[model samples]
Target chain A: MNILVLLRMVPDVVEELEIAPDGRTLDTEYLRMIVNESDDHALEQALILKERKGGKVTVLALDAPDVDDVLFSAVAKGADRVMKIEGGDGGVTTRAAAGMFAEIIRNEKDLQPFDIVLTGVQAIDDLDALVAPILSHRLGLPYLAIVTKVTPDATGKSVTAIREFAGGVRGEFDVPLPAVLGIQAAEKPPRYVPVAKVRAAMKTSKIESIGVPTMADGGQPLLDVSHMRKPVVSGHAQMLDGEPEDVSKKLAGIFTERGLL
Target chain B: MSGNIWIVAEQWRGKLSEITFESLALGREVADGLGVKLQAVLLGHDVQNLSTSLGMADSVIYVDHTELADPGASAQASALAQLVRQQKPRTVIVPLTNVSLGTGTLLGEQVGAPVVNFCKDLRAADGHIVADCVLYGGKIEATVTPRGDLTVIGLWPGSRPPDKGRSDRNPPVETQTVTFADQPSVKLRSYIEPDASDVDITQQDVLVAVGRGIQSQENVALAEELAASLGGAVCGSRPVIDQGWLPLSRQVGKSGLNVKPKLYLALGISGAPEHLEGMKDAPLIVAVNSDPDAPIFNVAHYGVVADAMDMIPTLKETVLALRG
Candidate 1:
């Protein structure tokens, strides 16, 4: 049972995002990038599966700001191999990204015969969340999204996935091996690796860099962004100010007026 | 290119989902704008009667198959793709939900059409469709146009009023047939429903919602105390529920319960679109977060740019003191 997990770096929404001068993209100069929350869960799920099934785990990521740190951290978290694909400056669409990944998984002789491919269910940037399904379609394999758990059968020919639907409804499915899954959460929270361990792993681990393939004409983005801007603040909220006590007093007054208290 | 507009009606457990109606409302607007027919595509086993409620569309395309009864994304996409290939609808609208999340993308790939997902709004612009899509959890908005004539749009929930999509008049139903080339590799085993023994957050009039800003399980007690003093209940965003600080029953978001409390006190919640979908309709919403730019403020009636941890204790005391 060999597992492959895909990691993506997304703009850290904790920091303010400013539109670039182009008005069609984010300003990359001051942007802080972090591993997408759900992608971190995908890596954690892959590691858990490796631990339970005695298989090798490989983490793949496209090139982006602070990507090296992410790959090194994956090594510290018990990933057996880390691979980085060059030439992604964080502007690629999900369709194009999926095409690149499918190419690598099929053409790369070294990363052959993977039983499973795991990726985040959705990224904040690409909320469309099309990569896993498009990739699965390209690879001619089964695909499942919003999966919380994966358990392999004794024969290793298939795996059972616990998929979540809207409103807390969950469905269990038997997916044959060599499938793609969009992970919503791992059974456990992502494990934190110490900086020292990452540093140590960085010294011993080698990140195999793969060059970007020449994409076909279909790789062109279907959706072209005409403009990107911050949401217009309606200023609907009557902002309360001052010390905590003062604000609390005002809130209490409002609640009393509304008969909530 | 002149073509019909299609809305893939989402159904679960023999009933159509809310997002289906939302898509119909949106699809109707786009269809009328483009001067094309609005068609609702319903695919399920023994579910032809579901078409009666889809009067919002000019017509309903019904497909019946046992394999589609509990279909995976692939089976559903394949069936839809077969119809799309034959009909060549200019735009296919799919609802972005956990059940049909992958359908649009899979259909786009299968039919060689481009997909624009997370679409909150769509309109015909100069005989072409344009979409307003939310990005980065509603921090940014992008106006997008598809480069191709035929495209798939994944409509997000809360995009339109579901009431506008409901109609008493039955639409003409057109039955379609599709055969799968191969058996779907994913087979449903069983559905694990949520725990029903816990409190129903939707019934509460007042909900004090917490998020990652609450930090730890111990901090949840603060929210609980605040809710208790207010004669309300304590609920949380997905982060807090995922962290095990609260039960799944207490989550207030898309995957959780769609709550419409009279007063929604949001503490530390940033108000992602998913979270907003559940609670934005509250009669009164007040939010407190360290980030003044949190999207919660967009929908909140009153907001405070302060730490929730510091405000919770004072709020509880103030409510108690005011009541006295």
Candidate 2:
């Protein structure tokens, strides 16, 4: 089995995000980029499948700030191969990114034909989560999102995917091989790779660099952002005054008045 | 090109989801703004009766097919694309949800229409539509415009109140037929329901919700005590549920149960947009988190900048004494 995982570095939301001077983009200065949470899970899922079924796991990432560290870390986490597509930046829209990924996956000569392609269900930046579907449409492959687990048949002809729906309901689907999946979570939490291991892999492993192909139609952006800003604060909360004791006392009084107690 | 405004009605397990109604309310506003008819596009098998409740739409465009019975993204997208191509609606609004997430994007891809997702508000501006969208989990907002004659919008939930979308009048229902060239490759085999033994968080009038700040499973017991004192139930944010600190049924978020409790006590929850989508409708919200800048405070009626771990035990004791 040959499994391909797509990794994306998104602006870490834990830090304060500043709007760039362009007014339509984020400030890259002092910005921290980290592996999108679910993308890490996608790598973990691919690794788990490889461990069980004996397969090669190749991880691919677009060029962006701090993306080299993510690709190197994937190598430490048991990825068989890691490739970086150059000329791509963090500001690319999901549509353009999907186009680039499809182009690379189709044209990369050294990589083996992949039976499964996996990516995170969504990213914080691109909350619309259109990459997998658009990529699947371009590749003419079956697509499934919010998948929690994947099990391949002994014949390797198809796989059963466990997809999550709202309200704690899960649906199992039978998808043929050569499909794309938007992994919501892995069977286990992503395994932690130590800093020392990542450093060692950075010294030993070679990250294959491939130039991004000229995008079709220059990747016309479907949606254009006219303005970007912080969310307007609607109503400010009446902040409670003092120590835990005083606050709890006041909260209890309100609860009693509201008949919640 | 001038045309009608369309909303794709989402149904699962024979009932329409709340986001469907929310979309209708938003569609009604945008439609009224654009001076166009609001149309509800209902596609499902044996589900024509569901259209009666969609009175907000000027008309109900119904398409019944066996392949669309299970909410497969590809089949529904194909059907919707065909309808869009033929009908030429000005805008197609789809709810951004787990069940219908891929429909809008795939339809856009199929029909060569521009799509704007995560839309919080839409307005008619100078003969064009402008959408205010939330990005990066609600930290940043983007005002976007689709560059096309027809645009598909993936609307986020909680944009409009569901009650505003509900109406008593039955809209006109028009049935349409569509054919598929090939069967969808993804097939739904079975659905696993949540464990029935767990407490239903939606029914609780008072909820003490925990997030990553609850620290550990041991700390959850403290929250349980607080909930008991307040005659309520305990729920957690996605991070808490993801960490296995609570069962999936006890989760409160976009993928979990939507609860409108009388009093929602959010403890340590940073209020990611997904979590807010579930519980933002509560009557009274009070949040306690160490970080003052946590987004939970934005919607919270009252806030205390303190560690939830320190406040949970004290709050429980204080509530019990106040009741006595």
lDDT of all predictions, in order shown? 0.89, 0.88
Q: For model 1, which pairs clash?
A: none
Clash count, one per candidate: 0, 0
The 10 consecutive residues of candidate 2 chain B with the worst lDDT sum are B178-187
Per-model DockQ = 0.75, 0.67
TM-score of each candidate structure, all chains considered together: 0.97, 0.94
Error of 2 at A201 (Å): 1.8
| DockQ of predicted candidate 1 | 0.75
Candidate 1, residues A1-261, lDDT tens digits: the string is 799999888998879999999999999999999998888989988999988998899988989989999999999999999999996555887778888888888889888889999999888877334779988998899899988888888889899999987777789999998999999888777888999999999899999999877666546777778999999865668899999999998998888898877
Deviation (Å) of A182 in candidate 2: 1.1
lDDT of 2 by residue, A1-261 (tens): 799999888887767889999999899997999988888999999999999999899998888888889998999999989998886544788777878888888877656578999998888777333788888888888999888899998789889999988988989999988999998888777888999999999999999988877877577787788889988998967899898899998888777788776
Fill in the DockQ of model 2: 0.67
